[model samples]
Target: MQYSTKTKFFNKTLSVFMTVLSPVILLTSVQAKEQIPLSETRCLQKSGYQPAHKFSPEIREVTIGNQLFDSIFSLGVKNFSEYKAYIVCRIPVNKQSHNTEFRVKFGIKDDANYETAKKTKVTFFLDGQAVESQILQIGQIATQNLEVSKNNNISIEVTCTQKLYTLDYCPAVEFVEASFF
Candidate 1:
């Protein structure tokens, strides 16, 4: 009976010591990854987008499509001619982390007044190779979980052409929730 009571006491004391020490250890490992904003690189060749591109004055916090996102960059309003936009972000690789990725939530801004694009062609490239391509429509957004390649470069290309039947006006697109994790 005495042995059992001593064993229980020892276990409780060890548990308390571990509980107190865990936070200090965990805090040292926890960190936020700082990422740079996207810029134009001719959308990474003609296969994706044209070299002529422009961006919003600054990165802004925007509430779009029922979600609040940070570091949102957008293009200025332009004419309804041939429209294509692109963003190329080169992520800094952490050699220690194995499964690093560049994650982003983006879509055409859901604007009813036609300030936002109705539909556009979106493509993703990793390490200068096409990985995913799709049509991003109005009131909707898509996410790309791009794994970091050795080059650590990820490019996003959004384009609009005359092929789309319904929507005639060329509207701007909003890039939301861009980050590296």
Candidate 2:
């Protein structure tokens, strides 16, 4: 049998092309099999919070001046008593071995009357455990970092306990951002 020079060159080229393309196709198929949800930040409205007082316990999307924000978790409590607000969010996990990290940033809205602002106590919880607690005051921003293992629900409870006071005021805790990665 006699093979032409062009046929020999074509056979070699085909062999090289198959060798290079095999791994690329295999890699693509493997990646497609494992579909991981992208990490993202969701608003409190989407995450689910109990509704209260028209605006209380609602995710308030507001534009202040030129700044735009939609992550504010507001809880309006008016009185000198104990008030608790729970903001629960479920993190998506495809497998039991997957670990997710959550970052919760929040602050107390400043009030003209400093005494009214300092009368609130806020506590943060992960799952069902008390992770962090603080006496929320004006000009204070707090962050809670939690590492969640396996697939489970993440519940954030913001309990605002107001002390006995004379003036009438409604205190609220504004969540700046809640990010999961």
Candidate 3:
């Protein structure tokens, strides 16, 4: 059977378009599943101190009194190909308060928002190891950065000195953002 010129041209163009589109679609699908092991992982632990929460209502908040004030947020990170999680927080001290002493911890969650073995490499900069097996505190609000991986729940435990009676004491924590590139 003989075909019209217009029909032949249309079929040729459609075939060409499909050929190009198929590869692009396939490539995209393959790329999406490609998992590259992160080499230079600053803090790409499978899990942090707690299972990462999916959502955090208050991205940032300040706690009052000398107590363990915490805000939980879960990052729905099933698995990562590359990149690390960091809890970059800022602590502020009230003028009258003695350099506030506090310890910040991050971990992965179990059934509840509890700590698990799949925690990230714990790095403490503010305090030292003496009081608790995994606890440290420095009486100061020195801007600090803590690293974690996988799913992590973060909290800051503080103990303000009584001397700072006139000063307002609180731990200011802020989850800046995450990067996988």
lDDT of each: 0.59, 0.55, 0.31
Task: Give lDDT for model 2.
Answer: 0.55
**Per-residue lDDT of 1-181 in model 3, one digit per residue for the tens?**
9999999999999999999899988876554322211121222222224544333234333232222333333222211212223332223322333223433323322222211112222233222222222211221122333332222233323222122223232122222222221
lDDT string, candidate 1, 95-122, tens digits: 4444366677776665524544456667
Error of 1 at 61 (Å): 5.7
Question: What is residue 27's positional error in candidate 1, in angstroms?
Answer: 8.9
The sequence of per-residue lDDT tens digits that candidate 2 reaches over residues 152-173 is 5666555445555654544556
TM-score between model 1 and native: 0.58
Query: Of the candidates shown, which would achieve the greatest lDDT relative to the real structure?
Result: 1
Estimate the Cα RMSD of every predicted model relative to the unseen true structure: 6.4, 7.3, 18.5
Ranking 1 against 3 by TM-score, winner: 1
The TM-scores of all predictions, comma-separated, are 0.58, 0.54, 0.25
